[model samples]
Each structure stands twice: as structure tokens, then as C-alpha cells.
Target: MAMSRNLTLLFYVTLLLIVLTTNQAESLSSQLSQPQSQSGHSMYGATQGSLNPQACGPRCTMRCSATAYKKPCLFFCNKCCAKCLCVPPGTFGNKQLCPCYNNWKTKRGGPKCP
Candidate 1:
């Protein structure tokens, strides 16, 4: 009887964890889908509806703007943007804004995206 009770408790705990994880994942998905502003205007001054391949230049430029190293920063930022189709807002941090851009890793196991 004790063993059965333990098993039931473990099962409930696992199910609770799964439900919590699913809710968190859904919340994150919604946040990632929505733009920073109600108007869909990004911090980079472009509307989400207007973003395109050609617009990567300005976005990447803005992302790499405050970096001490300009050339390499722009290079990698643009490359990541080209492939990921998005750039995290601001000069640094806020990587969670772009999952593809943020999840990329370098050969050395460091962050590949700026």
C-alpha cells in the first residue's frame, strides 16, 4: 500500500510538471509571436509586417551599433540575421526575443549570435 501511494504521488508530480511546462511554453510562444508594441513596431523602428530580407541590413546594423568591435560584430550579426530572419532588439542582451538567433552556438560552444 505504501509503495502504491508513492507511485501515485510520483505520477501526479510528473503530470503537474508537464502541465506547468506546457503552460510556460505556450506563454513564451505568444510573447515571441507578438511585437514589442501594440502597433507591431519593433525597437529597431520597423513594423513586424514590413520586415524582409532587404531590411536585415538596418536591423543588424542597429544590433551591432554599440559593440566595441564593429566589423566582426556586423559580420556575424548579419549572417545570423540572414539565416534566422530576426535580430534581437537593442545593442546587447534581450536574446530571448529571437530564439533562432539566440540559440545559435559557436564552434567553441559560445553564443554564435551577437
Candidate 2:
């Protein structure tokens, strides 16, 4: 009889532990899936990201390295990356990162970047 009681107690303890661990894992995954930012607009603005240079690097490089137009290319690319929070792939032509940066037009209706 004493052995049966100990077994029942151990079973309940194991069940409680499983329940607690499952709940904790679900909570952690939910937190990870959402993006977080401090500033209300511009930096992240529900579309772009904050001042994450690492995230902006590839996009900026792809854009700025494509041509002899160095100063303006980097300037505009960085500005767009800051606002859009992404850059496309190659060094010549790709707008996959941020469509806002891609579809954006110049005053004369020309492509803005090199």
C-alpha cells in the first residue's frame, strides 16, 4: 500500500512538470516570432528596421558597389535601407529586399540608384 501511494505521487509530479514545460515553450516561441522595436516610426515603422548595420550590410553593398557612382549610391542606399530595413541580392539589379526602395522613382522618373 505504501509503495502504491509513492507511485501515484510521483506520477502527479511528472505530469505537473510536463505541463509547466510545455507552457513555457509555447510562451517563448510566441515571443520569438514577433519583431520588437523601441521607436514608434521611421526606424522600424512596421516596415523597416532599426539602426541594424549588420542587417543593412548586404543590401547596401549590393547597391553601392554596382557602379562608379559611389557617394550618392551609398548615401541613397543607406537611406533606403534605414527606412526599408533590407537590401536585395546582387550588385547590379535586384529590388527584392524592400519594394518601397525598389519602386521609388526619381523626379525625372529615372531609376534612383546605380
Candidate 3:
């Protein structure tokens, strides 16, 4: 009788573990399938005024570098100047350091300067 009780207990424990694992996997799958929000937009890295001609430019031909991690503006200043402008994630073009090409700049390995 004791052997039968031990077997039943083990069986119940195994079933509980399986159920827990299955539920965990389902939760993970659902989370992965859900869409992410970017700048209050429903697409990755998309924002309002992203396609505005005035913000981008009338005839801007500036292209982003292949290795640039952030989105490049369509009208960034060329490398010949000391001060340039950068387009922040959620807003339009904003003034920034010339050669750095980022909204924030760093000096001597310190924190970024806005």
C-alpha cells in the first residue's frame, strides 16, 4: 500500500511540472508575438514626422552610413563643418555638434553633452 501511495504522489508531481512548463512556454510565445512600440508608434523605430518633407528636406540626398546604428537624417551637413544637426528619435531635426553627427556629444570619455 505504501508503494502505491509513493507512485501516485510521484505521478501527480510529474503532471504538475508538465503543466507549469507548458504554461510558461505559452506565455513566452505570446510575449514574443506581440508587437513592440517605438516613440508611441506601433512599428520599430517609427515616429511622427518621419516622412515629413519639411523636416527631411525638399531635395535631400544625404544617406546614412551602412554602419550607423541610429537613423540618419536626409539632410545632415557634410563633413566640412564644425557644427551640424541631428534628428532625435521622436522629434524632427535638432541642432548638435558639427562633426559628431549625434544629438549628444562626449568629451574625454565623460557623459554625453546635450
Per-model clash counts, in order, read 0, 0, 3
lDDT of 2 by residue, 1-114 (tens): 999999999999999999999999998876555455464222222233433666665557656775888778888877777766655556655563446767777899976644
Ranking by lDDT: 1, 2, 3
Worst 10 residues of 3 by lDDT: 77-86
- The runs of at least 3 residues in candidate 1 whose Cα sits more than 4 Å from the true structure, single-residue gaps closed, are 1-33, 41-50
Task: Looking at model 2, report the run of 10 residues with the lowest lDDT sum.
Answer: 39-48
Q: Residue 83 CA error for candidate 3 (Å)?
A: 50
* 91 Cα displacement, candidate 3 (Å): 15
lDDT, residue 79, candidate 1 = 87
**Per TM-score, what order, best first?**
1, 2, 3
lDDT of 1 by residue, 12-81 (tens): 9999999999999998887576666766555453333335678788888888888899899999988887
In order, the Cα lDDT scores of the candidates are 0.78, 0.64, 0.39
Give each model a TM-score.
0.61, 0.47, 0.33
lDDT of 3 by residue, 27-108 (tens): 8776555444654432321222233334333212233332242223332322211132222332323323212434334466
Q: Candidate 2: which pairs clash? A: none
- TM-score-best of 1 and 2: 1
Candidate achieving higher lDDT, 2 or 3: 2
Residue 50 Cα positional deviation in candidate 2, in Å, after optimal superposition: 9.9
The residue pairs found clashing in candidate 1 are none
